[model samples]
Target: MNIQDLRYFHELVNLKSYTKTAEKFGVSQPTITAAVKRLENKLGTTFLIRDQSHKSIIITRVGMQFDEHVQSILNELRIAEEEIKQNESATIPFGLPPIIGRNYFPTLVPTLLDKGILHRLNVIENGSYDLYHLLLDGHINFSMLGLTKVNPEPGIRLKIIKHYPMNIIVSKKHPLAHKKAISFKEIANENFIGLSSDYIHTRALDRMLKQSKISINTIYRSPDVMVVKSLVAQNLGISYLTTLSITKHDDVVSIPLLDANQPEFILAAATRENHIMTAKEEELWDILTK
Candidate 1:
């Protein structure tokens, strides 16, 4: 079957109107009708049936099933086109989440500069959740993803760089700050500050709470880690964060959770499984994986 026929048929299924599909594709109504007929003939099944007035159509069960495949096919083609374009471009589209970019990514910059690939980077900074989707959709070439756990996805390759324990952070003056470690039960009813849902910390926090059967009052949420740290430093509320974000310069104390099985914050480098890296991209990937 012709590729154009697949496009026409896909849109026809979505719009459910021959005139609208034809208008959208800038083709005649007969062309749309012929495309559908060609696909049905090739498949050896009746995909659709038009009413006597030819003004409406009823998609057969086979048609719906085929439409699902068509959607996947079209999406793959779109990603293929984007990947080809990315290969042709001189600059690499790199994704970095804010937390990783701020705390972890700087460690790689010196090596990147030494390798002379730093100038070729076109960075897209966002939360890990958004960066993961962007990399999967072919909007970015590679991403340094921060996640609560290793989530396996088809057509994506992930290399675990490091794992840091998620820790509880509180102001120096807080009652629990002097403790070496604490359990979720000790602070279950305390006021809490938390990162926004976009961050992986939120997922780890939620899972910890659920597993421990504990709940706390979250007084504030911020996408900025600094804001969360500031709130915690002022003794307004306690927060959870990864160890990578903690430093001697910060006023807050990082205390480990005493849970038997605490979730870890994972740092990973992600790229499309099918992507053929250019020489420069390969060098960058090597440095990252190292």
Candidate 2:
């Protein structure tokens, strides 16, 4: 019936347990029960059914229909809060890829902080897929991601910051290191240190390799780009990686791919489509793109 009651309902549906919801909200179980009961009474409909055997609550069809509206209301509340904060002071909560955060942003962070227009800045290092979801969910105001192509979401705007080429990385002592370019077929039989299957980069590589009738003999899998680079440096395996990932490494050698002509990945910055940018964020975007 009220915002707090709706929030309680939403949390209960999400957690699927009144006790867990009570714990999360720091409220008594009876208080949570009372809230839900009052909401149900006001709505004149049964929104949830308890599965006694599993001790879990299940949303009914009517609940499912109402949930969409509830989510929209929550989103609006979040936007309202964000706008109020924006009016008081300018801040940009940005997200960046782990590789970028480690290698590039340290120098820029101090300068941005010194600018003084930046009231607050939050930087998170995460994978590109996770970054995409964070941007879509309004958890981050902006994100820098490595993607092959731009697929615009309904309320998102994207700017391609750079195009990094793909390269085959191997130990300096490896035979392919001397080559100007190596073909997929040449590395097909080589032991490969690769990104994990969940990563977007891995999916793109898999699609390309599948088309070439080549499969990497993956000997190691990791989410960390640095880990894959280190394994290649140890002569354990060869890996297909971006130039950005390999250019600074001294232990490994990178050779351009002979057959793969497309850009390895496009590093992009994205923000909400219609959102107003703070001056600091706008300046940061300019610096990144330039």
For each candidate in the order shown, give its overall lDDT on alpha carbons.
0.91, 0.78
Off by over 4 Å in 1: none
Model 1 pairs whose backbones collide: none
RMSD of 1: 1.4
Best by TM-score: 1
lDDT per residue (tens digit) for residues 1-290 in model 1: 69899999999988889989999999999999999999998889998888768689899999999999998898889888887887777889999988889898899999999999999999999988999999888888899998877876898899999999999999999999999999988888889999999888898888899999999999999999998898899999999999998888889999998897788989999999988899999999999899
Clashes (backbone N, CA, C under 3 Å), per candidate, total 0, 0
Model 2 Cα lDDT, one tens digit per residue, 1-290? 58988888888888889999999999998888888788789989888998989988889988878778888889868875775575465556678887666665665666666765334666777888888887877777787788877777798888887778777788998988889876777887899888876466686778668867987788779988888888888899888777777656459998887775454677787888757776677787776565
